[model samples]
Each structure stands twice: as structure tokens, then as C-alpha cells.
Target: MAGQQVYLDHNATGPMHPEVVAAVLPYIQGGFGNPSAPYAIGQENHRAVDRAREQVAGLVGATAGDVVFTGGGTEANNLAISGAFLGRSEPMRRHLVLSAIEHPSVRETCAWLEAVHGAEVTVVGVGCDGRVRLDELAAALRPDTLLVTVMHANNETGVLQPVAEIGQLLRDRGVRFHVDGVQAAGRIPVDVAAIGCQSYSLSAHKFGGLKGTGALILRDPSGVMPILQGGHQERGWRAGTENVPGIVSMGAAADVARRDLSANMAHGLALRVIFDNLSARIPQCWRNGHAGLRLPNTTSLCCYHADAMSVVLALSSVGISVGTGSACASHSQEPSHVLLAMGLDEQAAFCTIRISTGPENTVEEARWAADQIAQAVERVRLVTAPEDIGGCGEDCPCFAHSSR
Candidate 1:
């Protein structure tokens, strides 16, 4: 029972930690009550939600009062982008800026503002290494620029942006700054006061908590408005009954992450070595994203002259979990807008696989996963090759062909 399967897609969604599960079980089964109700059980549920806020805020170096809970990262992102822009006074601010390589939630939110709300948007492009240019960011700021939103880590590349540098640049500019910390929240240490961003967003599932619960951190100076209005919930920022159990689990998970991130990063670093070596053995294998300064758990490798979906399916057969591009946007065949904006061609974009390691994976499990992946890539490459299409050394049913 110790090592039956290897899960290497933590970036897509980390497995729920047992401690978090244990803490959350009672809330789901016995502690079910609406936080808004005036009864004793409901008040108890509200306290659990408040405690979760403290845990989350502690992880980000903020007070619990500043955290506003939302449905998930997407909702948090939407609330941050749309809510902040909507809160601005007319004539004082009219422009918005975001990184081109941002998650779709941010990218799409910016687009919606421009198309639907008639706001001006400027999306700065990243270089080949998937980093936003700080100089470009400084140049783009305007007197009318209402907000600047960027991610702490790229969902596709795991490459971190210069958030503190950007924050410093915007310090005196009077522009409200927002950061999407959904991917980087628990994987890396985040200090909101030090980063100096006025607001930030995060999802529980990304960091080993249950899905459908997230938080938006807002500094009082930013004065963001609520996207929806109902009761006094989330201090009128997001209105819905507080999801007490999910919040309780998120707090439990946050506490665990704060204590265990160093060890988690170490485990990831070990797995990355095996992952990199396996990709190196393949023809034209190229590792994308930050070379050294990256998330410890993520490896985005592109196999040249092969199909990514095909390779993914082959590994899935052997119970290896992975992702091609952002799991949120995988339904679309269009190249990862994040990678493409970072200077990858369509072919390179299509050939990518994202593997993220968890603390549960052992070194042997990591190596075995690498072996299976290498074999799968080779098998798929041979099948897709025109010359090898007709003949086979050891004929096997082509899973990739059937999937296509």
C-alpha cells in the first residue's frame, strides 16, 4: 500500500493530504451548517471558516481580515480583475496591464474587460525563457493605468515572474497591483507584504486542499468592489454561503504546506532529475521554462517530432498522470497561448508534457515513471513516422492512432 502508483501531476491538482481529509471529514458529515445562520452550529461553522482564513493569510504574510473567500481560483481571478477595475473611479484610471503568458483566467478576464466593459488593456509579452521584461512593464505603466495583474508562477512553464521588482516599480505609480498566486501559493513561499502587490488570488486544490474553494487577498488601499452582492458574506466582496468544510480543509492543508514545503521541494528536485534524464534520452527533447530558477516540482518537456496527446495516452495506460498545457484549457487544440507568447512555435508547443511531483512519490517511483515515459515517447514517435508507419519490429496495438 505504500507505493502502488506514482502521481506526477501536482500542478494540475495535488492529491488531498490525509491530514486535511481527516480535519475536513467531520465538517462534511456532521458539522454541516450555513455560516450565515444565527444558530450555534452555524456559528461554529463560521468559526471554522474564520480559522481557515487565518491559516491562509499566515501562509501569505497577511492578516485574516484581508482574505476574501471565493468559489475557486477562476472565480477569485474574475473577482480580482473585474472587481478591481469596476471599483475604479472614472477619469482617474482607465487602463489595465497583464503579462501575455498569464493563465487563461487572467488573460480571458482582461479580454472580457476590453470587449465587454470597454476598458483598455495592454498585455506584455514574455521572452523565450517565459519571463516578463521588467523594463517593458515599467514603460507600460500610465497615469490612467488602474491596475497591473501578473502571475507569481506561470501555469505552463512554472517560471516565476519578477513580482517584487514589478511591485517596486509600481510603488509610486498609484496603480493597483494584483497577482494570481493560484499555481505558486503553496509550492513557493509567498509574502504579500514583501511582494507589495495590493491583491492576490489562490485556489485550494492547487496546494492540496479540496477544489471549489479559494481566497482573494485585498489590501485596504486597493478598494476592490464585489463582483456580486447579496448578504454581508466576504464583507460584500463575494456573496454566497460560506463553504465551511472546504474552508476548514484548506486551512488544515495550508498549515501542512507551511510546515512541509521545504521537504516537498526536495522530493520534487529529486524527481526532476529523473524526468530530465529521461527526456534527454529522446530525440530533440527540449526542456522549457526557467532552467534553474523554477518551481521545484514541475518539468515541462517537449519531445520533438512526436505527438503530445499520443505520448500522454501511452503513459496513461501505465497509470502515469500528466498534462499537456494547462489542464483548465486542454479541451481546446489551439497551442498554449502561454508558451506561444513565450516564443515557442506550434510544433514545439504541441509536443510538450507537464509532470509535477508530489511528496508521496519515491525516488524509485520517479525513475520508473521516467522509464515508462521514455518508452512511450519512442513508441509513439515510431508510429507517427511515415517510413515506420507500415512496418513494425514488435507489432503492438497503437493506442495513439485510435485516440486520434
Candidate 2:
């Protein structure tokens, strides 16, 4: 392994920005007063938290009063789905709509609702390009549908959904909409008003802030009920004492991300160009998402005949970090559900890996990482038996060639 590591898994988590770290250090060290207390020190912390709310709101084009801080993105998503459902009346809350490629947080929460609360779930499928089929989504909606939740960008394939259009459709139908913006918030321009979603969720760690902190932006705070009932924190939307330091860090990160959004996007595009050029040289290796309709920083590549796990391990041995899918489900031995929904078979899905870049990643690092990936895939393919080389069956060119 090399002494210097090249990180390409920004979708899972990004390194904290120096400014964010500096911003949070004071809160961690001496700004320890509880925001709920009546003392002067407590008032100061409360003011700081309020400022952070505005900063986070600015990143998503939302009002400060609409932002509700939570423990993390998972909790934010849980609050968005479960809280909205629980707040609704009987028949209205009976049905829910979701995309096929949502993060496990949204998927599992809906599953729980179906099992426990008897909510009917309609999971709309995606096209081969990993984009949700709008017609299918429209068809899935019913009078009993309470809410439709979809992610702005897929965590595994990075494909951007037709959120604005979906929002318009839901608006015309008088149905509520929620968007999981965890992977899209810092990477792209996000206007909640433009999206027309009633609620949106984002995580700090996916950008350049500390982990264990996130926020849910609500267009109408009264539309959803609180899952955690205790303090009057977050305007009665969420309970428990505030995470002052983490919230401060998120504010700092959001400010920087908004300021450098264009520059960061350009940097990501440059890295992707390098990766695409190099990876194109590898045999039977293809991108998994829409070529132009995905996040600038994310690349999902499938190297046929190379086991994704083996490739990931080989790249790790060389100090290049990547991921097979969402970090939340990394421990699962199952193939990527995102790819499968996009029409990839299990074997093709198992041979896929994700590379998501960040502002800190340089063009030189991207070149080195792409080269390492190609070499790693080659190494894995060399060891794979002919029988295991083709997942496309008898008509597959690779399968026919290997048989001879």
C-alpha cells in the first residue's frame, strides 16, 4: 500500500473542511452552555444555533424557520416519512409512494410503516439509466396516497431524479412530496421552492461537515408530527437538546459549499473526465448511470468478470478508497439494489463499484486512482475463471468467446 491514500468515496462521507473544524472547536472547548437554559451563556449558544439554522437554510434555498436539526440524515429521513404519515388521518395515510433506488433509510422506514401501521407501499421502478420512470410513478399514485418520497440523487449510481417535475405532478394531485437531498445538497444547487417538496433531508458529513448531524427543511412545519417527544427544540418538530458543535460545523461547511459550489463542480468535472478517459480503456467496463444526468463528482462503474468486492479489496491494498454502494448497507452481502432496479442482473450489480470525488481531490490524484482501478480490475479478472466471466448468459459475446 502507498503511504498517501486517495479517497474517492465522498458520497459515503467527506473529510471535514478546515474552516468547519475551526468553527466547531470553540463550541467543543468552552461553549458548553445548554441552549435551553435562561442564563446569558445559554442565550449565546441559542443565538449561535439560530445562526446555524439560517446558514443551513441558505444552502437549500429555504427559510431559517423551516430548518429542523436532527441527529443525522437517517433520523431526518425517518422524521420526514414517519412523522408525515403519523400526522395524517386514517385513509389519507394508508398509501405511500417511493422510488426504487432510495437510500436504505427511506426504504426501511417505509417498510416498517407497511409492516407495523398497515401502509401500502408502491415502489416505482427506474429505467436502465437509473432514472425513475415518471409514468410509472404517476400510475402508482392513488387517492389514498399520503406522500411520495424520492431522493434527489441516488447514493449508488448518482443519477439525478426529476424532482421538479415530480413535485409539480404531486402538487397538481394534492399529494405531499418529500425529497432526500443528502447526496445532492452540497454537490449541486438545491432550491426547495423550485423542487416544490414539502420536506427535504440532508446530512452534514456528505458535504464537509462533521457526522452525526443533519437537518430536515419543512415548507410547513405543522404538516408533520415529532417522532421524539420531549423538549420544545426545533420549533416542536424535533426533540432533545441541540448538538451545538456539530450544528456550528454544519453551518460553516454550508457557507463554504455555497460560496465554492461552482468551483467545486468544475473540479469534480475535471476529475470525472480523467476517470472516464482511463476507465474506458478497461474491457467490459461500463458506467452504471445516465452519462449527463448525474452528479458531477460521482461515477458508478461495472467491470464485468471482476468481483466488486475483490476489486474493492485490491484497490484498498493500494490505498485507493471506493465503495460498492451506500455506506449504510456496506456490511450486507447483497448486490446493489440500485443497479438491479436499473435492469442490471445480480452478477453485473456485484461487479459494480462507485467512485465519488470531492473538492479536496486533485486532478493528479484522480489520474492515479483511475489507473490503480484499471489495474485492480485487471488483476481480479485475470484470476476469475472463464465460467464466471460472463453474467449475460449464452448470447453474451464474452461468454461465447470464453467457451471456446
Candidate 3:
């Protein structure tokens, strides 16, 4: 077991960047003042928030006014979905469409709306390649469809969705579109206008900022209602006192991500290539998702006849951190819904693990991590009996539907 620790789960969350930490130090130390206060210190903090807004907007090709800071990505998603549906004047437009592979934040929010608010929800399926089926999405639309929400990039498989095409399709149909850009914002070049989404969601933690801060970029704030009602903060779009230090940290992280976008992407691509080549040597170990149309930093590997959780534990024992699926649903015993939506059987879904690199990772680390993963999978397969190594227990819902 290596003494040194390697973190390859950037999709779940990442350590704060040094620049981000530096940017927030003053606010945390003594620069604390309520942005709403009518004093000099308050005005200063207010301006800081405005500057942070502009910085985040610059990275996503949005205006400062379009950025509304929220508690996190999940809150941003809730605001986008629930706000849009609840804010509309016409109750007839109650139909909502979503991609089957969206993060739990998006999926669960939509489900809540259907259950509690009488909204009609339609989930469009994905192909074996892990990309959403555009034709199926089009077929699922209706005259009463209020919105279509899809992720810009998938968290589990790292597959890039056809957001531009979907945007155009929804535009032609006169329907609103929302993009969950949580995993895409800092990793890829994003232009909300170019993508034609009415709203977009991103979490700062995914890109090296603090976990409690995120933002929603709204093309027109008037189109959605405020989910949190109170004093006029965030231009009355979001309520409650501003998180000064966290927002400032997000701004600094955004600036660093924008400046090093090209170089960081190249570095990640190099590391992915190295890791993929090395891991391919393992028997029956195949990479999931579209090879050419996925995030450069993410790799989803499925090892046949190996329990994914066992592999995760083995890797952890060796001072390596990875994920079986979304960290949000880490406690769930079910197999990955994203993989199942992409046509993987329950057994295959249970055998998958996700490895997402970050700016701090290096080519040498990628190679070593892949070697460790291969050894871990081998050990897991050797210990578990063949019949006992398959999908979840019979009590699991997926077990009933599984062909295995």
C-alpha cells in the first residue's frame, strides 16, 4: 500500500484552490460585514459580491446580472426547476421533460413537482453510448411542455450531452430549456447564449471553490420565481444574507479556471489517455461513455465479475480515493441509474467505478492510480465467489429486473 494519497474523484468534489483560499482569507479573518447594512463596510462587501458575480459570469459567457448565487448546485437546480414551474402564469403548461441520466438534484426535483404539484414529467432515455437520444427527446415533447432540462455533462459517465441541438429543438418548439452544468462549467468552455439555455446551474466546489457556494445563470430572471421568499437579496431572485467569503472564493476559482482552461484541458486529456491505455490491460475491463465526446478529466471503468464497492474499498486502503457513482447517492444500495439508463445490465452497473481527475493531478499519478485500480479489481474478483459476485441482493428492486 502506498503511503501517499491520490484523489481522483473530482466529480464528487475537489479541494479548494490555493488562489481561492487566498482570496477568501480576508473575508474570513475580519472583513465581515452584512452586505445589506447601510455602512461603509457593508457597501464594500456588497461591491465584493458584485465583483464575484461578474467573475463567475465571465467564465460562462453570461452577464453579471444573470448570476444568482445560491447555497449549492442542488439548491440552484431546485430553483431552476421549481421556480420555472411554479412561476408560470399559465397552469396549462405543466408538462416537464428531462434526460434520464440527470443528476439526482434535477431528477428528484422534477419528481417532487410531479408528486406534489401535478406537473407531468417525461424522462427521455439514453443510448448505449451514454448520450441522451435526441430523437426520443423530441418525441416525448408535448404542446403543454413547460421546460426541458438536461445536463451539459454527465457526472457518472462524463458523457457530453447534445445541449446545443436540444436547445435549438426546444427553441423551435417555443419551450424553455435548462442545463445542469455542475460538472461542465470549469471543465469545458461554456457559453449560455451559444447553448441557448434559459437557465444553467453550477457548483463551485466541483471546480475548486467552497462546497457551500454555487450559482444559477438565468437568461431572464423575470422568467422564474423566487423559491426562497424574504428580504431582497440577489436582486430579489434569491433571499437570505450573502455568503461573502464563499462567493469571493468562487470568483477567484472561476478566474483561475478561465485563464488556464486550455492548458488544464490539455493536461487532463494527457492523463486520461495514459490511464485509459494502462487500465485497458485488465481483462474484461472496458471504459464506459462516448470515447470522443466525454470530459477529458473523467473516466468510468467497468470491470466484469468484480464488485465495484470492493474495488473502491481496496483502492481506499492503498490511499487512493475514487467513486462507485455519484457522491450524492453514495448511501444508496442501488446500482448506478446513469449506467442502467445507458443500457447496462444491473451487474455491469454494479461493476462500474468513476475516476475524475483535477488540475492538481499529474500523468505519473494517473499511471500509478490505474495500476492500483487494476490490482484492486483482480483481488476483489479472486476473493468473491463467481455466483455471489453479481448484482445487488434479491431484495433490491433492480435484482428483480436484472437478467443475471
Sort by lDDT, best first: what order? 3, 2, 1
lDDT (10s digit) by residue, model 1, range 202-312: 899888899999998886535567887777897777787888877887899889999998888887788888887766688789889778878888889988767777787
* Predicted structure 2, TM vs. truth: 0.94
The sequence of per-residue lDDT tens digits that candidate 2 reaches over residues 1-404 is: 25679999999998999999999998999989899999988988999899999999999999998899999899999999999888875555579999999999999999999999888999999999999999999999998888999999999988999999999899877688999999999899999999999999999999999999999998865557899988899888878999999898889999999999999998999998777665578989888889999999999998888888778989998888999866765655567888889999878887888999999998888888888999999889889864563244444453223533
In order of TM-score, best first, we have: 3, 2, 1
TM-score-best of 2 and 3 = 3
Instruction: Tell me the lDDT of candidate 2.
Output: 0.89
Clashes in model 1: which pairs? Answer: none
Off by over 4 Å in 1: 1-4, 385-404
Report the lDDT tens digits of candidate 3 across residue range 218-263: 8866557999988799989889999999899889999999998999
Screening candidate 2 with a backbone cut-off below 3 angstroms (N, C-alpha, C), the clashing residue pairs are: none
Compare the candidates by lDDT and give the number of the best one.
3
The deviation in Å at residue 56 for candidate 1 is 0.5
The 0-to-1 C-alpha lDDT of every candidate, in the order given, reads 0.84, 0.89, 0.90
Please, what's the RMSD in Å of model 1?
4.6
All candidates: TM-score? 0.93, 0.94, 0.96
